[model samples]
Target: MGDTSDFDRFYTDLKETEKKDSVLTSKQQIDRLLRPGSTYLNLNPFEVLQIPPDSDVDFAKKKYKKLSLLIHPDKNADDRERADRAFDVVKKAIKMIEDPDELARCRETYTEARARLAIIMSEKRRKQKKDGLGDKIPEDEPAAYNKALWVVVTKVFADREKKRKMLEERANEEKRRAAEELVAAAEKRRKEEEFAKNYEESRDERRGTWRQFMAKKARKEGEGKSLRGTAFRPPKLKLETSGK
Candidate 1:
């Protein structure tokens, strides 16, 4: 709300006022830092070291040392293994946040969280104003940021899954259409072959009919010539018979 540029100032102020001289026992540290869902919670370095993103190098160093002493494996001999694991996480947190680049990245995520919160709250207030309700939108920070982060995460995953399904559907449709086209082409080729074969058979039948007609015409012409020859020979045969 006011000068929320970085969490370093917040961490400095919180360290001086909140985590100053107070020291927690190893068991207490374990309960607070090594709880069941701590693994996911500790993903954020700021959350891991229990410091703000705007924390300075001095503050990060102090917080790291404090946590180290509290959860030192050697100190917590009864639960050495868990203590070591927790200590490693704290050590990593300090190392990561101390770096300028990593710190900036953390700040970016926090800022993004803030931006999302603003959008959500603005929309909510707009709706309330429309409904004649007072604009009493929630002003929870870092927490609102977390909510915003979740919204982005869920949207990204949903969008990716939707795209994947659409791509799969497109591939399936293309495959189906290709199969249909292949079948149609095969049917077309088969019909063409059938037509060609029938055409050849019909041509041969016509040729045979034409040959038969030509042979019958030739025989009729020969018979007509023989009849003319017989008519010419008839007078010779009658005269010979009368003289006898």
Candidate 2:
């Protein structure tokens, strides 16, 4: 039983080693075949797409479609796993390069990456100079050392774009809310004005009725006084009694 267990462990280890070796072989092939350089092939999207740096929209779209089809996983099923990763890279590159907004973001990312690389290289150079190895250090290696810089730069730009869009949406929402508030305020003012106009008209009408009522009462009192003044009085009742 122990012997069988040992054999099983050895088989598993051997299989793991073989798998590791295969993965390593694939990695080496990818590095050798796909790596871009300044002299041979610039990794810049325009260069890879075989278009001018200032290519128009139509050209960019064409290049993106062509590259997508070329590196599509279905077409490269023999290495579908690697092909899928490559396709993703190509897609990201297209996104970073095609749209004007995305292109601007990419340029900003490139600038930041260059600045960071400069800082790192400057420190390295400073250290080398301090150690009396300045003569051995090469200045042409900064660009070469920035192999993974694009990945970092792209992420930063993507994050910035997301935040910018969120801010724009928030601003739009605030503007919409402000507009609604203005409309509501105007409606309230309209209602208030209407109420004030109706109240003023009603007050005027009541004032007219009160003035008419007062005039009518004054006229009735005058007539009653006149009638009392003009009334016939029983005059000489005293004289008649004296005759009797």
Candidate 3:
């Protein structure tokens, strides 16, 4: 806050730490690649390549070659597994840089960061002026501006990743539900077909049972008529006359 150069000094110290990565051994590079926060950090291809986002694809390709060699599994046979993973990370970053759409998105993220940083600096200047403090903004320095830009860029990438994951999950859920509905519809149709088949297969048996019932009823009626005709009347009329 006292001197604008202090901000520059702070930014310089951070860059110096990053510069040390260039000379790191293969083991160290693997460790850094697979570090605790690497998942979040690796969201930015620029961060993975250790290059500025504004760099052209050619420059990014060159950087990728150097980083790839540093962490290549063939170069570090003792730690091949980790080195292979690190190598994959580098490969993905280079692929993103080569892709026109992804490269454009990366550039847009940097632009957004710059725009957000500008708004923040503008607000800070406003507050300082209102408080009668001289309008000297530390982030006006190139180093300080870069340092602030880094923060905003990281945030933008993270937000984008979060939203992407959410949308993906939603789409997967919809697909699952649609698949289940298709299975249910197929099952319903199968049951209906099975019922129709059974009904058709039993038609002949039902007709045979009906014919047997009708024949039995006719035979009983014929036997009743035959009994009535053959039944004896006896001499009942003559006995009744003698009693009278």
The lDDT of each candidate is 0.70, 0.61, 0.85
Model 2 segments more than 4 A misplaced: 1-62, 67-105, 120-144, 200-204, 212-244
**lDDT value, candidate 3, whole model:** 0.85
> In candidate 3, what are the lDDT values of residues 66-127, reduced to their tens digit?
88988899999988988899999999999999999999998898888889988999999999
lDDT of 1 by residue, 1-244 (tens): 1464544454354344335336656776766567654555565677667766678889889878887888899899999988888888888788878788877766776666657657877898899889998887554466444444544433433444467689999999999999999999999999999999998979989899899998899899999988878845455454445554
Question: Which scores higher on TM-score, 2 or 3?
Answer: 3
Q: Which order, best to worst by lDDT? A: 3, 1, 2
Q: Which candidate comes out best when scored by lDDT?
A: 3
* Tens digits of lDDT, candidate 2, 1-244: 1585664564354335434432434343333225433222324454345454456767788867866676677877788887776666666667657668866654565677667766766787789889988634454565345333543443455556668789999999999999999999999999999999999889978999999999999999999999989869787655344554
- Displacement of the residue 17 alpha carbon in candidate 3, Å: 3.5
Model 1, residue 152: displacement in angstroms?
9.6
Candidate 2 TM-score versus the reference? 0.44
